[model samples]
Target: MPTPDFIRDLRRHVGTAELWIPAVRAVVVRRRADGRVLPSPEVLLVRRSDDGAWTVTAGILEPGEDPADGAIREVQEETALTACPVRVAGVFAHGPVEYTNGDRCRYLDTVFEMETLDGEPRVNDDESIDVGWFPVTALPESLAEDQRMVIGWALDAGAPAQFTEPGTSHTEAAGEPAAQHD
Candidate 1:
């Protein structure tokens, strides 16, 4: 979809300043006919209209919205798919992305491992040009780096949510699970 009304309103005051936005990604995975997710599973991906890059369904979280709900909402909005979030797959800080319009944003992104509840994939909104599923081993070459990492987390069944630590690159931190604190 277009820039959300809340962000547009914020832009009126901030004017291209870097804003820390909360975003969510739904890495919707499809199980085999026998209900098996292992070996090789399919993942839903969209080809973005702006960049034509393949990525999982993702969008900015609405104010006060739960992150998982935001992820489900984005999947429906962008790909016409109803999904249920199974677990948080990862969380990461991504981007000081400078848009063509000069809006800059750094996103604190929550990634969810989701299952498709219903509906076939289709480009349901202006944000994406196409939508389809691909096996994890055969993902599009144009998939974004961060998205690839999040998908990896989702595919690693039973793994804890992945997180990056200070002074570590995302690749270096990929295998590290979020620490549990007492």
Candidate 2:
């Protein structure tokens, strides 16, 4: 999707200045017909149109929107899937992202562990070029480190929501650093 109208309006005033944006990520996992989370579950991922990288469903929250609602909305909009937010998996301050257009922003991200309720995965919007599910043990190499970290938190459902302290990397916050599997 194009930049939201509210952000565009803000951009007109702030130009490319760094903005603190609230965003949400949905780590959607599919369960078995018996309602148990699969012993080896699959996660919904989108291949981003902007960079062709595989990542969890994520987007900026609309002003005044509840973070969980925004996560559900983004999943439906981006992947044509309906998901229920099971829990808040993690929160992080991510990026001083510089877009190709030169817009800069840092995201305060709320990550949710979601259960897929219905619908097939597909590229439902322009933001993504493809959408599909991959087993947690065999995710695509293109997925980013931060995305992988959030996925790990979601899978470790019993663990408390992970948070990062200022100047600490996600690995340090979560403990020992490792690869995507964490």
Q: Give the local distance difference test score of model 1.
A: 0.80
Choose the strongest candidate by lDDT: 2
Error of 1 at 5 (Å): 0.4
Off by over 4 Å in 1: 33-39, 168-182
Candidate 2 lDDT over 28-103, as tens digits, reads 9875646576778899998888767788998889999999999999999998888989999999875666676898
Pairs of colliding residues, candidate 2? none
Which 10 consecutive positions of candidate 2 have the poorest summed lDDT? 173-182
Alpha carbon RMSD to native, model 1: 5.8
Give one digit per residue, the lDDT tens place, for model 1 in 51-107: 677788888888899998898899999888899999999887755566767888777
User: How many backbone collisions does model 1 have?
Assistant: 0
> What lDDT does each candidate get?
0.80, 0.82
